[model samples]
Target: MTTIEAPSGRTTTPDVQHIDVLVVGAGISGIGAAYHLQHEQPGRSFLLLDALDERGGTWRTHRYPGARSDSDLFTFGYGFKPWRGPSIATADEILAYLDEVIEENDLAQYIRYRHRVTAASWSSEERRYTVEVTREDTGEHLRFTTDFLWMCQGYYDHDKPFQPNWQGMDEFRGQTIHPQQWPEDLDCTGKRVVVIGSGATAATLIPAIAESAKHVTMLQRSPTFFISRPKVAELAATLRALEIPDEWTHEIMRRASFAQGEELWRMSVETPDALREFLIESMRPLLPDGFDIDKHFNPTYRPWQQRLAAVPEGDLFTALREGKASVVTDTIERFTETGIRLTSGEELEADIVVTATGFDLSLFGNVAFTVDGEPVDFTQQVTYRGIMITGVPNMAYVFGYFRASWTLRADLVSQFVCRLLTKMDEQGTPVVVPQLRPEDADMPLLDWSDPENFNPGYVMRSQHRMFKRGDREPWTHHKEYTEERDILPTADLDDGLVYRR
Candidate 1:
């Protein structure tokens, strides 16, 4: 821990004391919260603690052979930090970028690495939170309290990988791997591979494994409806220009690109049938001539009902079209001697198997939260603009838009939260809570995650209840910035957010 002078010209320590804010998790969201909190409110004291020794939550944990961002770099990057590299950035590059941002902002002083927060209990009488954390390296437990608690801890538990129960999965002779916990020593040189799951992980894994594997078959219980488009060069270029010091140019292109994504999202939901057919047609050439598009591409649910895989460089489609990658729409009954046995009474042999099945959506580590020692379950809570979980006060969690670059939404959420905190101080409000009214509860939460909902990962599970049903634009996720601004701006804080004494 390093020390820095607060705005009041006093020495300050982020840890070992009651802070203005206690942010859990050192991932992008946590970093964003800490960065903005310090930059915008230097006088306010806050501490960022992570269970892991280092930052970069998901990006740090899941480092498979070909890990990279499928979303455009411009949109994927933090608003405060400009992504100067090519449109696509590798996992390592992203992790480096995160570290760079922390260093540039002098945020390391506030971060306590290897400190895992076990449980948090809110004190209504004190109007504060008491948190319990364990040091991973020292094996010592410590207790601390803060005026507010921010659950920046991402949705997945590091120990729990979403491994589905395949009947014969244990009997497989070939090695089995999950991308989340990919082993460093594992190699797939000239090996025949079978990747289970047709979601983002499978899409990314198939292409990378194709380069080294003799053959890689993407075995999906059903076909996933994916959409592809050219790299948003215009958007990227526009963001680059805005990253300059000039505020005018920055605001112009920022609003433009934001509105553009919003328009696209609107177009997607308004004309579902034509767009759905167009998407199906777009995929026809990549599949076998007589392949059943209806069975594979024609999902049972509506479009954007679950996440639509982004084929930025068409890597997955390129592999399929080049005969290097193939998709098998079959159910895996269990693990076979060398591969997977399908429910169709057939066997596909492989040297290794990768399960990209998906994730579990248990919010906050399936851990218990208590206010004044009374239990508080996030599932029993409502999300405020998908940020701060209701019934929790003076704290905020920043996540990305389901349809857009996560950072885009994260950036906005960070800004809004900082402004909210500032507003609270200005108004002498000690506590703020965004509680949804009964009428608002009648509104829908969209689930743009995996339709099948088999894997219980964080993002998918959150999406399952994050948005209103059928209200795709604002409720689910708005890829566009224009619409998001209207809903996320500081002026809209009065919608239902309550500021308590």
Candidate 2:
């Protein structure tokens, strides 16, 4: 085994492998990073390490019935590859599409599955990051040194879904389940199920299992904004009918989707009341006549305050109209033996309960990080364009957009990282870090994100654990895709970045 001497005069063993770049998480972001690295920087050696046993990060982990993409595939799919499927695709369909990308690009060889990264430490003397990994299959520990670290592990805790504890939960005899860890053996046939929460997971699950289950009821303390649209993209369909190239169709549809997304965001900002009315009235026709839309469908928060759940073809409303599913907007007093008791003096009887609350945010895959000999405190640092953090050297993470498709931002970040790498090669520099400028010493720091802009339950719950952001550009994590698209491509690399040999 190749041994390397540690900074403390201790010898580290077990064969240390070295690479030019180490991409963490073989999911969508990581895969995209690998593709860009291979295509743009062919001379750089890179490896992808994922904790899971396979690829397709979220798609693989979420196996609930009717699990699908909330965002349209045209924008969600990679820029280089074209999405030939419907706008909103199922999890299986997404996994298949990812598989094709891997096969076409031959990226499987560079990916190491089931290798969980435990910790990462940067060495200033060597100008590299040493990442410690644990092989899940054989329980073997390994180390890899790399000049650059790309974090694509995503932002949620996969193993532990946010399970809110209600009073008398233990006393309830029904089978309790969270969508994150759905049990394959459990059958919902002819069961009366009550799902808690009004987010995307609950929106997706209720319609999916409504037909099979005897009855499904969605219980929520408050309502969320929902947008229903057809699964097929009219422009994409028209282009394909004319025998236009797949790549051309993809680009056209992607831009159209972006434009539509921009309009929605504009409506939310400029005229929120009009946008809210449009959303509510759109669902009125699909729902049963005289349904309590205001009580169940209306949200107190303004449009775009939280993410708007997209229901393809109004499937959720269809389920409600067919009497297979229903929605109850009320607070839960406690869980009962049969089901739950609401604060309104009502009881909901059920044989099963699904908590579609949310998931805990896992910043940087919950990996402990150290710079030189000092432990890095992420909450104390400010973000640099939401990619690189202050005082963290040779590391960049991909945190996608909340309003727009995630891959749109992922693609931009990948391009920027590649550009940075090219500049480093030209300057013969091995280390680069984001540092504050002298004039910016007194800059005010704020929460990771503005609640008014985007405040989901999960994000609000974990904002304290995230890195701070400044009020100015290059120091903030702006969520607008149109603005970022214009700014990121030609961003000055040396603005806040300090490069060293």
Candidate 3:
């Protein structure tokens, strides 16, 4: 990396030093980008920065009691970095794996920790980005200009928690907390707990909290379709014994699993009555006799239309069956002094309340972006292959598919970024950006996910800001990494993404 002084009063680094590539967020996307860049372009210059002192974005940030990856380890693990742990890796294990990847690839040298990028502006005259970043430790600020930017920053923002305006939440005289900001020293053992919202986080939080909490009441506005399977360790073991490469094995298993789910999705959407009856029948035995499973278990949308909750080996169902846990499918009327009042005139008393509502999905912390000295609104921009933002030259953001393992999509995005950069270098292209035609608005790009603005208000917020193109083809989300493999690394980059030589 080279540093150069600029005439704009701020001491800047090489438009080239920070140039070849500037990867933000040290999570899966950042590590993946650095890993591929080092291998593909050995002599290229780059830097990776994260807000935290250590690496491993989400895996490091979230330390809830039983945090773990919902995706199978095979698919969740980096394609190049095969996960040797259980198929479903605990949060700790995932963090460790990220550490291993960083050390093994010697990516530490390229990473500048605690350097949180606040804003990035594209320079029209120089054809690069002027990034403003602050050091988290000393409050020291610095401005660095770069030729290219790679946003490996995941969709969610760290500081913001999704807390909806509850009728009497503020009036309650107790401590309330959101799972994303779970207190490290929190002690909920033997205390009555109420975890609100029904999503993946809720699923994970319920089981873990039930292990110690006196009584964990799960409150949901509506019941979500849930499926359970064995953890990744078992699956990984079976695949390893057969001498299958981790990525290949992972892709095959995940693809098959998703295909089955997709078929079910089709059924739920095509034959709503049959699917509803099937779901009711499956969950009939769990609820009290004469209880309406249709009211609670049935959703307004089709299965897999949003995201399906992954339960571990029917643990959640078993917990409910054994009477250790209970579910209340009702809206919160208000928060009482000691507990929450339901819309059904029922009071659920709790010593502690856990909001497992879900996450707020914002792209890059909702930072205002400028390309070529022109302000770019993400809502006004279209995503190139759902990775590169239009009008932003030489930059790529790694976002995941709702239907598949996150790492699979992220790794693919990382690989494609490296390839795109290599091609740019070979062709002597200094800048590249998506140049979608004005008439290309009719093409679909994303799947239908949480359209009702449900779960953890942040997702709804991000969805509103996101450019949703409903096409399920080359631009659509397939959720299977194998099917998408050829599409990214080998896709005609020049078709949608404009490359200037």
Candidate 4:
């Protein structure tokens, strides 16, 4: 946020806001970045811009029934702030946590809500970015100039979810709903609900709606790994019984989760077959006797191929055992008047159909970028520590870890950005860009296109659009939080980057 005057020699007006550092999106990443900027670089002036009217990003936007944390809260929460509650938390609980962070950190004064960014133009002459945005309330256009642009809006398109082109979808008489657009007056009581796509959304919704819905059937083209977890925290309880503080308990639990996740990946590489069997057998008792574990629970891919969805209190399995819920692993042939017809020659009746499909993942929230009035294609660039694109200067985007808590990486990114700015201050440098080495051109490139590499459905669909990763750092992501933790914090900025005054 260290700055001089605008290089264009333009004077600031009432509608024009001049900032040293502007962090986009007021969600988890933006808030964390703001905190780091305030604490680490106290002299820098900054503000947060969110497209929505409020903050809390995903947690605030997704309010579907049974919407909660799929990952443990201890790690999901900010490193500075302790969750100090259940392993998995509801959306409201998380939103409240974020509110508390903002209130305690006094972030409210710096946040300018309802500023939907449309495009950004980087001016080499000015050494600044001219950001164009629209005020949602009045549709008024405003401009802002900033020394550094931090994209913390996340990597997904919030405008729409991915909906497959299914035949006869419009002909169905039953109500069709997408979890991303869940209605406030949605009536599922005593109704037959068919939740489609067995990802986190389906896993969360089926059990939640099963309590009141006459019957809930989870229909998926392919099965996903679902692991049931108890509501109580055994480790935490034991630790607190011995008089240890809740904060200490949270740290211990966090590290334990990290180690377990790393071990699971290791097992996947060494003994995938045995590990798969072990995981399937672990869930046998939860379901009714003689259940087909291979067909419904076991995914076609090897274990750790994708993230496992965590279910609370074994509610999903209990619902299945008590015959209140069922799962169907088949392709949707078409939609009938009263239900959906499967390709396996089966028709299931449903009063309401919820498409719990994945998101339309986009890089930098689909922000249009122009360097010196020329549009930049990020796909041709290499990422630096998965934070900054090679050709993009004085900009960093926050992309969290896939396996572990997202904030774990966000926390590191915040620290790195702060240090980067401080180093720039000391060196009298105003610009930093990743400069690919000469030999890097001969080095092989990697993409997240294949499921074997990084097989999340969301990424697979948009792999071609994302920036390429090299075989090694600061251009590649190892996908392991432990390795990233060891590398990113102390990673040298000049390794593949160029600094300019």
Q: lDDT: which candidate is best?
A: 2
Q: CA lDDT, every prediction? A: 0.72, 0.93, 0.74, 0.85
- Tell me which of candidates 3 and 4 scores higher on lDDT: 4
- Between 1 and 3, whose lDDT is larger? 3
Q: Each candidate's TM vs. the true structure?
A: 0.84, 0.97, 0.87, 0.95
Error of 3 at 330 (Å): 0.6
The TM-score of candidate 3 is 0.87
Ranking by TM-score: 2, 4, 3, 1
Residues 1-501 of candidate 3 have per-residue lDDT tens digits of 565555653455433235567888888888888888888878878898788888888888787878887776766777676667765668999988888998888889999999889889987567788888867886656677777888888878787766887888877776788988989999888988888987778788778878777888889998887766577545556778999986677666666656755576667568867866776576666555655567666777666566767776766776676666788899888998899999889999988888887777767756668776677776656666777776777777887866667877887887787778778888998888877654566664552243532233455556666754434333434344546766776788767667775
Question: 3 or 4, which is superior by TM-score?
Answer: 4
Local error of candidate 1 at residue 84 (angstroms) = 1.3
lDDT of 2 at 339: 95
Error of 3 at 464 (Å): 3.3
Ranking by lDDT: 2, 4, 3, 1
lDDT digits (tens) for residues 258-343 of candidate 4: 88788888888899998888788878889988888789999988777788888888888899999999989999999988999999
Worst 10 residues of 2 by lDDT: 3-12
Error of 4 at 277 (Å): 1.5
The residue ranges of model 4 lying beyond 4 angstroms of the native Cα positions read 1-14, 448-450
Candidate 3, lDDT over the whole model: 0.74
